[model samples]
Target: MAKRRLIKALAALLAVLAVIGIARAGGLYLNHTASYPRGLWQKSGDYDPTHAGEHPYVLACAPGKSVRREFIERGYLPWGFDCDGVEALLKRIWAVAGDRWTVTDAGIEVNGQLVPNTQPLTEDSAGRSMPVQTGGIVPVGHVLLLSDYHPRSFDGRYFGTTPIKDLISEVTPLWTESP
Candidate 1:
């Protein structure tokens, strides 16, 4: 009977620990939810853990209307805004201000060098055709967000460039993992 009681106690302890962990993961504090430092789960291959060490993260504040529309269509509210959408995004700087950027339906080139695996698609998942914006001088106060790792990443290839006004902060990953 003592052994059974000890086992039951251990199971109960484990259950409590599990609940705490789940609450923490879900941003819940006891019965309430914590609000600071909102967490975002990344499901796409645009950015990878391997590149985090090599690149300094740039948290851009500017999210254009097209990107906002795309996020809404995809059912992602990211920053908790109902219509305006996420005000900032953590993206690696693929092309910076004053760099010669050329974009075409075939691929993208930065400073005359073809960015690997950055081919623009003719159509998206919804069968809507994608537009091609020819390469041009990356204007002052604008940045391009693209990843060589993700062949099909939705980035500058589809949305063009991000203005500096939309940038909010440059952030380092506090905790990240791949599923």
Candidate 2:
């Protein structure tokens, strides 16, 4: 019995290591945050990372240093995602460049359609005041990102549109649990 248990543990460890290795080599990611579903996501084919608006969801660097700090300190972003000294943020491209975006009491509106789960909060869960974006046309090279799946997600509603250059990669869900 003891020998069997030891073999099982070793097998489990090897399986985990193999999964991680395959994920790294194949540009796959595991979503652990509630902002999206918790599961596996694979990066789309290599393309122009400069076209942030073209993708539905992207892995990006936090909009600014202060924003990154806030997310890290607040426990919103994971420390494990440190890439090139910057933390990664997953965002859904709500509005592409040239789309008119507005912030209202109800929620964020894209071209006059109110996007659900985007009502910017005045204060975070810890009572810290959150940044509220001013409404405007999405500037060139910028895309408005949001988390419609999670209301409290610290996303573009707080920081407005992000530059296309911030996009690290486009990804698609392979398997995920409902959020």
**TM-score, every prediction:** 0.57, 0.80
Candidate 2, lDDT over the whole model: 0.79
Q: What is the lDDT of residue 161 in candidate 2?
A: 83
- Flag regions of model 2 displaced more than 4 Å: 1-21, 46-55, 85-87
Give the number of the best model, judged by TM-score.
Answer: 2
- List clashing residue pairs in candidate 2: none
- Cα RMSD, model 2: 4.0
Worst 10 residues of 2 by lDDT: 46-55
**lDDT by residue (tens digit), candidate 2, 71-126:** 77777667754344644677788887688999999999988988888888999888
- The clash count for each model shown is 8, 0
Error of 1 at 169 (Å): 1.5
Shift in Å, residue 120, candidate 1: 1.0
